[model samples]
Target chain A: MSGCRDWLAHLVLGLGAALFLLPIWLAFCAATLDPAAIDRGELSLVPRLDHLGVFLEVLRHGGPGVGPVWRMLAVSAAMALAIALGKIAISILSAYAVVFFRFPFRRTAFWIIFVTLMLPVEVRIIPTYAVMADLHFIDTFQGLTVPLIASATATLLFRQTFVAIPDELLEAARMDGAGPLRFLWDVVLPVSAANLAALFVILFVYGWNQYLWPLLAATSPRLDTVVIGIVKMIGIDTSTEWNKVMATAVLALVPPVLVVVGLQRWFVKGLTEGEK
Target chain B: MERRTIFPGWRLPLLLVAPQLLLTLVFFYWPAAEGLWQSLTRTDAFGIHTRFVGLANFAALFADPRYRSSVAITLVFCAAVTALSLGSGLVLALAADRELRGRDLYRVLLIWPYAVAPAIAAVLWLLLLNPQIGTIGRWLVALGVHWDYALNGTQALLLVIVASAWKQVSYNFLFVLAGLQSIPRAVIEAARMDGAKGFHRFRTIQLPLLAPTLFFLVIVDLVYAAFDTFGVIQAMTQGGPGRATETLVFKVYQDGVVNLDLGSSAAQSVVLMGGVILLTALQFRFLGRRVAS
Candidate 1:
């Protein structure tokens, strides 16, 4: 900013970046190493390249007390995507209804949904688990996704977006005898596409990073998400393959990080704008 | 907040809202009500022979030294995490806000950590902090420091705190940077014209403007530290080394899931739900005033 500030800024930022990357770099290096090498703990800076196959090895066969990495990856993907889309769909609908249509108990219904902000599945996991068990949805995709899909954040965001849409456009749509569904499909959705896209990235990451819900809901080994499996693998009392554990951790983080980086612009926009 | 143009059909709105309402009722309100109810009742080991124990579970929780310890650790954890993450985040944001070379590259590098799941972040730190074969752990040992989180409760707590804060710094950075950038260029120019350059201008002008953002970040980080760090504690320490790292969130899980102490867990959940409601209310109050003015 000032004459002497440039170098200082760069230094500070560079140090921060290095601090953040150091762990991941170590993980990456170890992931490519033989178990014996990792056991030695030299943690060579130079790539060993001897066990590049560890990634596939870990993917094909998981460590103790865990399933195949690919299936865990798929479960993570499914949970993340389902939560994202389900939240977007339900929130958009509810937001549209609350913002655009006046009903008898509209305010009551809105508060009912809004109060959900207070209780995450974490805070109420015991009861939520009981519900899941009662419905026989435990270990099911619906259990992992449905309870998580009702999003106060997205609903609030969509409501703000929908409310910001000029009255003129909706009136114009109505003048053409367009019904509510048609108006939502053609006008509201198209207008809110940016918000929706931004929200998708945010929600996808939120869903992908879920730890406790999947841990509780999916007890079946086949259903264990990577986040859960990583802990289970490391949590076991037996000997842990540090290399594979690091490899699996790498697999666990890569997708969500890619989503954030690939959609960087929208992610920031959604965070700041959605907060407002 | 009324929309001027409206869809006039009541039936359609009802149908549209039904799915969300149903899901909310099924997953949210019902369980929340149940959590509340469970907090009031005590069940035997088998969940049968249930009896109403109004406020007994809560009283017992407060009476229990372990619960108090959990709350104390959570408070301490929240304090350390909020300070560490927010402070580093502010510095990072300030540095990255400059028009230096490759600032965008730095920003991208810093922000991607937000995608790291909390447990994975813990695992990352575990790899670096584990005394056996860890990088920094070896360094610490070489420096004559006894670096073992497994056997030492304080070290375990510190490890979880650092790892938790590390995961959160990226989030705070984004918000802080946005807050910094949102300070109008014209205002900064005006301050600079008055010889309020560098740290003087920032401390006098920019910091006050960024107060609201800082406050919001503090609360956000507090809630994150309290609730969202279950994964980190679970993965890293499992609340071990004599229950040192056991925060309220983890205790809720441990007691409820591992120990099957449903009443205690439910009571704790209710308390946590109260915390969330209070935090949300604080946020909305400040936010509402901000919007109003």
Candidate 2:
């Protein structure tokens, strides 16, 4: 009975996995088909080999009211990188400060950061946009990344990690006449390397997948990120090149998927270990 | 949570925390405060004169039937996405938790969908269910059933809900699986010895232990469905078939960005902020005890 149950579990999981991938596989197949074939409303589950030129065509010839696919991809890549790096740098420092030091207004500082969670960018778009406009940061990279990175989720994660560090490491560093900075550089950092890697994977994906903020912040066609750019290509009209749109969707999913797959080990380990 | 080790410093810590504090102040606190202030004030469409309207915007929003329906729509959407994502996630997690072969492979297969952007997920679904060329659409037509999300509010809502839930299943599955693994093996052994097995054991033993995780996921999924689903809804339905699928977050965007109704949008923002604050409070109250799931 146990053996049968185990096989049943496998079957269930296998089917679930296939269900999850079906839409994506359909998209990939559609991306490989010509526009006429797609418009015929009879999508071939088996992809045609010669129609692979759609990817190149979408890349080379920009769609209506949008720039080239490469530009949107580039903008997305840049925004993701900048936001990931900027958030990590700032969050690491702040988390380090809270966990490693005794200072005035420390709790207040933490609360302030925590209170930022009260409203996500979606809730406060109007005033946040107004703030961006007031600073002339609208349509700039600073505008695209800065406001959205203000959350405490990451800083809190780092704080938890920092608090878990063995005190002996810090004591030993202090015994070696190390300043706070030195201890942070040599000991704190290396100790938290796994966490930093995991957060990088997460923040990069978070930054890459941002849609609402980017849609609101980055207005210029040249500045459009792939997530926003690709969504715009779906004009809901009959004239939309469904094949090209499908191709763009594939390009958009590549980077974040690669990041997650490559770092899956670190991500899972960090999550379970950190919690336990 | 206090660390016994001490690094005594006022200057360096201040320097260390400055960037985040500055960013938070400028981008978070300042904007939130401005949102509150803006809700009380109305500006003409041309950006001419501004006057403090006190509670007029709030009154108008409360009286607007569209806004009230958006609230109902948000709750329905939230409940559906949460249930669907969590339900599927629990199934996947339970199956993967069993003594099965190729579990590692199954995990990686399921988790990568978490990385797909919500908007991208929506588009993939859009293609899959496209009335013109979607294979599923073709199947529906072959069955003599009309399926057009673009023109049907119910269909549009269903499409958005599926797209939103699809991306979140990865997150829920990861959490649920972790929760399952953390359950002690001896507990399951004890349950087995007591003649509890399979569905009965899952219900009597595993599920009660999984409550904290289930609750945590509910809060997190609700937040995701409410706020982060702006992309999915925007891409899939744009709150359309005539605002039938419009959630509160999308309403904020539509009223604020699309219509440029600054006062009412800010008021809506304030209301949405209240909902989030309430949820965040609930999460914190329950979450701090559970390693935040």
Best candidate, TM-score? 1
lDDT of 1: 0.89
Stretches off by above 4 angstroms in model 1 are: none
- For candidate 2, list the clashing residue pairs, or say none: none
Docking class of 2: medium
Kindly give the stretch of ten consecutive residues in candidate 1 chain B with the minimal lDDT sum: B284-293
B136-199, model 1: which lDDT tens digit per residue? 8989999999888889999999999999999999999999899999999999889988999778
Worst 10 contiguous positions by lDDT, candidate 1 chain A: A39-48
Write one digit per residue (lDDT tens) for candidate 2, span A39-105.
8986767887788887887787767657889888888899899888898899989999999998899
Q: Which candidate is the best by lDDT?
A: 1
The residue pairs in collision within model 1 are: none
Write one digit per residue (lDDT tens) for candidate 1, span A1-276. Answer: 465788888888989999998899889888888777767677866656877788898899988888799999999999899999999999999999999999989999999988887567789899999988999999888888888998687888899898889999988999999999999999989888778878888888889989988888988887889999999988875677888899999999899999989988878887887672
**Alpha-carbon TM-score of each model against the true structure:** 0.98, 0.97
